[model samples]
Target chain A: MGLFSRLIAKVKGESGSQISASDWQELERALIESDLGVKGVSEIIELAKKERGEDIESSLTSALSSWLSTNSRQLASNSDRLTTVMVVGVNGTGKTTSTAKLASLLNNDGAKVVLAAADTFRAAATEQLQTWGARLNLEVVAGPQNGDPASVAFNGAAAAKESNASYLIVDTAGRLHTKSDLMDELGKVRRVIEKLTPVDEVLLVVDATTGQNGINQAKIFAESVSVTGLILTKLDGSAKGGIALAIERETKIPIKFIGTGEGAGDFAAFDATTYLQGLFQA
Target chain B: MFESLSNKFAGAFSALRNKGRLKSGDLSDIANEIKLALLDSDVAISVAEAFVKQIEDRSLAVLDDVNKSTNPSQAIFNIVNEELTAILGGSARRIRLAKNPPTVILLTGLQGAGKTSLAGKLAKWLKDQGNTPILIASDLQRPNAVTQLQVVGESVGVPVFAPEPGNGVGDPIRVAKDGIKFAKDKLHNIVIVDTAGRLGIDQELMQQARDIRDAVNPDEVLYVVDAMVGQDAVRTAQAFLDGVGFDAVVLTKLDGDARGGAALSITQITGKPIMFAATGEKVSDFDLFYPDRLASRILGLGDIQTLAETAKSAMDAETTAKFEKKFIEGADFTLDDFLSQLEAMKKMGSMTKLLGMIPGANSGAIKKQLEQFDDNELIKTQSIVQSMTPIERNDPKVLNGSRRARIAKGSGRAVSDVNSLVDRFQAAQKMMRQMRTGKGGMQMPPGMQMPPGMAAPAISKPVQPPKKKSRSGNPAKRALES
Candidate 1:
């Protein structure tokens, strides 16, 4: 059977005059299927069952949405202070692109933005940032390839200050949380950048498609750098980003951005209700 | 990260450990635990449910056997392990380098999933296996992607067929065709085509990847998924399967502390085999994915086999010969040797992953220590060695007060740190000399014996039966935990 038709059938079953014990079980399965995780799905079921009124679907959806949307999804940008945003995440999670997209957004909004390619370890990382910079008509501050990322971060902060840019976004190389030296290096990069300007936002970019592993990455990255907010990337139209709901609930870090597509302009401020709607939809 | 999940699975199975006859009800709790463990590892709920249900059904069938003499729990463990391995490792060793030249391999994945790195690693591996492999830079979407591929290819000593540098958003289809043709003409048997990935899987991105696949008509269209990828692994795999169907899945970044339970869902749901695993960032980190070994790893049986292979792989032939001549025949292990050993071990993987490979080293406290393992110790050691003069590196005695102070300053370390490093180096040298003279009967890990003089890491712990590989066979059935 088609997934859409099955979901519709399940929805119809849920709207019955009286919800049966099987109805709750079905509801539980539906939530789990949506990527809310076992923990999130169970808790949501309990919350919905306890506080649910006559309309079960609405109560559950609202519960899931409310819990996801509690975090204040705003970038730490102030008029007085230069916003130094450091982007970090696991390898292959669209960190550099997200950083550029954020920079593109700020630049379009008439904020002076400087891209700092602090991901000196990855091959052609600086060039990738430069290409993004060229496309957006912004300047990128890059260091030598395979050079000290900390120095590059320092230079980025310095360049932002020199150019009077509103935002200095430092794009770090994707390092696994399991690597302690890499984590320490990230911490060192932050400290180095802070020497020049206070790091306004330590944004942890997570792929929405990530599963239970997201929680572990979030917790570790958060512990290392006081990861202030999250950027959920690669959520173009996938149902699996449900792990984000669980991660959001657990880490308590609000997702500030959603990378919708590959295009430089495809990023948007995450709407919890809209995301939850996407999850519920077939 | 998998420790908790392993603990849950163990907790569930622990109930049936000493039971003489298994009741049908016993399978339920174990099944539930296995299901939870799978789900927690990020396996899709439906897939987890289906897998556990099968395990439950199989356990019941074993219990309802006519011959009540059989060990029901062992049967269940065997079934679970075999099924898990079947899903993971059954379809492995599938990459048959085309008998005809230009056996094209198109790699697809979400952006930043290490396609370029994989391409390099695959080329090196194929070359190591006596095949001429050339990399095709078909990922024209990302800026400087061709350059990046070229860089990776150069590092691996493989040639990369790339389009001329410009706005790299040139026709990837055209590039792919040209690359395949070039490999065919050059008589390179293996062609690895690296494609671009969108931050999100959009229509255009899919179309571009699809177009490249059609153009290449690759022998192997390997879907490279980051094992660290959580919930979205199955959906993404499904989308790729539908949009640009791949032959197999390659799990990358396994060395990363990934609860990549998504691998289970991808294999179980899509029926795709996880063919290869990229354990570390280096080109050498790539290896054949062993489902049996991985299943044992998930079950908290330490990965002794993979660990030994990692150590063995670290010792290239030249290094092995050098060690044999330098350490075994001529002299004791030097600071230079210590530094090189550190480099090799570091290349193997992160401390956490390495610890996971050691049998029973996954203790809670050790796992925690591994989390905070001063991985920088390798870098520090390297820097200290690099700071020293050649004479000082070859002979610890050469490192006098002035030299120690100078080396420490150069490496951005203190004199005390340098002194300690030298002291450790000397002690390690003495120990290696003793081992060379058979003073300590260090039991080398099985399946990893190589050329003489290759430093057999002091494995004081008992050599394990390679996770569950040996026990999964009939002959070693007696060794099953009673």
Candidate 2:
């Protein structure tokens, strides 16, 4: 059978009238087959059964869709003020890329954005952020790659304040979340930013392909710094988007943005309604 | 086998093996091995350090208790397993899907992690289990991803809903919304959306994905990854989790020569279960991942469960039924089946990786030989198969001189190319027949080795016939022959 036919079959499988009670067992199997972790499938089934009656399939679909939409919406809709977003994650998590992307998104929304290249460890990191700044035409305050990241954060906050930018996106050095010294450096950067201006948001940039390991990084980062939101990058390559549901279940962190691709315009804000609609579209 | 890891383990065991007592030095060696393995496998360095430290501390205190056991290897294995299990959590955790009918699954990953492929694979798996799935081609930036996805969708017989090019990545959310409404009108059940990928992690991409998440309101967000990336995959996963918190992880390319150290450590680091594993390129090459099997693979104790899971994940019920039917009918297995089998072998990862999986198949020369026959060659062979006419493909005997010329023209090759293909097919068929008849299986032809490298040979060697000599004619005949 072809891929499209199989997909159609899956969509048809949800038809309540076409399937018998024995076929319902296949629903769990279907979920597992779709890579929706076993626990996740059971959760969905239990939730669906509880709301069961007439039109169980539709009910289950809507229930699952709504549950996700509701949770994600609650997380992303956290107030409309300055909404300072500080990007954090280990090296190579695309922190720099995410920072630039966030700036572009905010700028596109008509908000003046300032980016702080506080990731002063890797030589290429600063240059990369600078290149992004040039492409997006956004203001960037960067320290030398080997310089103190906290200094960059302080300067960036000052620049944001002077420029009257609504959102100050700070790109911190990519350090292992489990490293105490690195976490301390991150804390210091946060302190510097707070001293310059109130630190409103802490966003952790995670590579979606790492599966649960990404979540583990989140846990450690959250411990090191009180992370407020998540930006899941590389959604385009990740086959198991289930990690988002898993992360939310484990950490209750709201995913603010998802990086679908490398393009500056590829980032999108998390929307619940469309997500629900997309889930059952098949 | 844990070829490299075995040496490390050997070093650790040797220290503890003869000492009749466990020392800090032995514990340190074991800890070092864990750290090195984790790092090599691409576990975040910090995570590796902390993990090794914890193991060291625990082992130091429990050495006396563990040393009392007669089997030192077992004791070490138990300890390592315990440490690994502790770090990874006791068991796997599952994602939290919505109670509604269309449970949304959002995929995220790095550019080369195969997220697009996973989306199709997942959709196919869902269809097999009797669910209706709509595949959304939301990856708007990458070159030809939508088309690739459409091809995948078509192959799986699933309908794909994609926004027009330049419509923006988030446009798919709106399209998906409309698709859902359409499905509702038509009563479709599930939708799987394929998103974009970046060369590296960037905030703009995350925001776009987040925007899609908001727009679509997906139930489960999965982080897809390439397991062969080792520690890099783990670090990247952590970054994504921090940015766009996902529900579970789907590890792809498990068939590669990855020690699977990242998979084992990722769960412990993120406190999330590896929901699924992708072992091959085929849509069916996905399995509902189990932690124990992964642990066993990491420890170099062959994971039969994982192997079975890989087969089950890759082969759909329909394909399996077809195979069963063919077996019952005692039908002649054709070249097409052989080609598919070869393709499947390629999907199991690099030749070196497959060899590593088999017991005692690890040898330097074998690894090099396996490396030679890579995926590129498989693709070329597939193209060659595609080039043949239906009759020519089904029956090699049908290709006479005229047919060979026609096929060569159609396939954009020389006549000799067609003849060689026919010969190879015939040879393969004969070998298959022999094997089926319980005769000796196919052996390597003299002086011919499986070509290494996926690229086609730069120069084709002309076919040579066996030379004959008349020994009875003595010196004159020998001179004449010379």
Q: How is the predicted docking of candidate 1 categorized under the CAPRI scheme?
A: medium
True contacts kept of each: 0.68, 0.01
Q: Which predicted model would earn the best DockQ?
A: 1
DockQ values of all predictions: 0.62, 0.02
Candidate 2's TM-score reads: 0.46
Which parts of model 1 are misplaced by more than 4 Å?
A1-17, A69-71, B18-20, B64-75, B164-168, B198-208, B316-351, B378-482
Provide the TM-score of chain B versus the true chain B for each model in turn: 0.75, 0.64
In order, candidate lDDTs are 0.76, 0.63
Please give me the DockQ of candidate 2 compared with the native complex. Answer: 0.02
Q: Which digits, one per residue and each the tens of the lDDT, describe model 2 over residues B1-482?
A: 23434345545555556766666776787787766656544454557778788778767677777777776546766777666666654666654545766777788776656687788888888898888888877876654467667767888888887665422334655665665566556555777878776433577767767777777787888888666443345445666777777778887766534445666556766777778888654577676776665555455554565445445645566767876687567676665665665566555544434444443233344434444433455555666666767666666555556666776776677765544444455555555566567687556342223321122232123221222212222423432332
Tell me how candidate 2 scores on lDDT.
Answer: 0.63
The residue-by-residue lDDT of candidate 1 on B144-205, one tens digit each, is 78888888889889998887563455788888899888887888888888888753347777
lDDT of 2 at A99: 87
